[model samples]
Target: MRYLCLIIAISLSSSAVFATEDMDAKLDNYRSAVGKLMKVLKPELVNAMKSKGPVAAIEVCNTKSPTMTNAVSQETGFVIQRTSLKPRNVSNTPDEWETKVLNQFEDRKAKGESPKKLEFYEIIENDGKRQIRYMKAIPTSKPCTICHGEMIPPPVQAKLKELYPADKAIGFKVGDLRGAFSIIDTITQ
Candidate 1:
């Protein structure tokens, strides 16, 4: 009986350690995927803004963002996308799970948490299949204001209207929560 009790205790402790390690691994994978997506997209946006202007940069986002996201997804073998409560693109609107997560992020930000450091992940199991979901908050920056700020230039506004007629990703200032990068993946155990 003593040996059985010892063995059970050890097993429970070891499983806790393994669960923690597993969570760490999942975080690493999710963070790397977000980094890669940013790396692929940020430079082009910067260059577009620098070379032409906010209007041209808007075009780049309209035409190139999906391609860039898809390429990153292919490279990383992960399903990744961006979402927001107020999305410039309708397709980028948050779904049910994402909506709940976005609201949580907003509440966290309101409580003085740094948006840049805000991230959430979940391990969901359904019918014996495991899925992982993660989201990292995206904070609005100065450059983003050129297109998404309260004072967008007329040309930028016209272009934005032309491309994203139903856009809601505006009226943001630096340090505001713009949205998040969301990733979903299934992992084999």
Candidate 2:
């Protein structure tokens, strides 16, 4: 009677707590993976920009980024990469879910959310498989403007055209939504 009701309440509350803890663990893992990737890639980009210039930095993005991304993915055991609504790389065109998140990110930004503080995640069950999908907003900074800005140097622009025939990643202002780092993890239970 009363005792049975108390037991059920405790059980339900404990399950909710466990669910929240699980989500926290997953979020920690996803954040670590993104940090590792930025760590591995940022130094190279800085050096390339300092010594060889933006055109050379473009080469870094074209040649080095994919290899580095794959290595980081292997190290973290997650499929992670950058994607955008206007992707410089055709291969980085967002999938349906990613597109939806990117749009939501935009909407949030419009409502005064800081780009660096913008993030979203969901555990989705699709076709009997569970997946955790996450995205963190990539804010456009001044340094990135050299390559991805509205006013590009002719040489840099030419190099970009040569490298990416259908580049649409330009025209971003500082503090704008450049894109996002996306992560996907398959959960088996």
Candidate 3:
């Protein structure tokens, strides 16, 4: 009886350790994928803003962002995208899970957590398949204000209206949580 109980306890403890390690590995991979997406997109945006201004930068986001995200997804094997409460692109609007997560992120930010450090991940079962979902918050910065701030330049506003007629992604200040990079992947057990 003592040996049986010891074996059972050992098994349970080892399973717990394995689970923690697995979660940590997944988190690292998700972080790397998000980092790659940002690294690829930020330069294009900066150059567009510097050379062609905020209107052109908006165009880059409208056109290049999706292509870049898809390429990253293909490379990383993670289905990745961006989402927000107030989305500039209609398609970038949060889904049900994303909405809940984003609201939690907002709460965290309100409680004085740094938006740059905001992130969340979890394992969820959907339709009988297990998956890991991760989100990393994007904070509004000084340059972001050129396109996303309260007082947009007329040209930038015109271009934004042309692209997103019902745009609601504005009135942001530096340090605000703009949105997040979200990644989801099936967990192969």
Clash pairs of candidate 2?
Answer: none
Q: Judge candidate 1 against the unseen true structure and give its global Cα lDDT, from 0 to 1.
A: 0.86
Where's the lowest-lDDT run of ten residues in candidate 2?
13-22
What is the clash count for each candidate, in the order shown?
Answer: 0, 0, 0
Q: Which residues of candidate 2, in runs, are more than 4 Å off?
A: 1-18
Instruction: Estimate every model's Cα lDDT from 0 to 1.
Output: 0.86, 0.88, 0.88
Candidate 2 residue lDDT tens string, 36-79: 77777778888999998888788788879888888877987878
Give, for candidate 3, the lowest lDDT window spanning 10 residues.
Answer: 14-23
Q: In model 3, which regions exceed 4 Å deviation?
A: 1-18
Candidate numbers, best TM-score first, in rank order: 3, 2, 1
Clashing pairs in 3: none
Cα miss at 172, model 1 (Å)? 0.5
Best by TM-score: 3
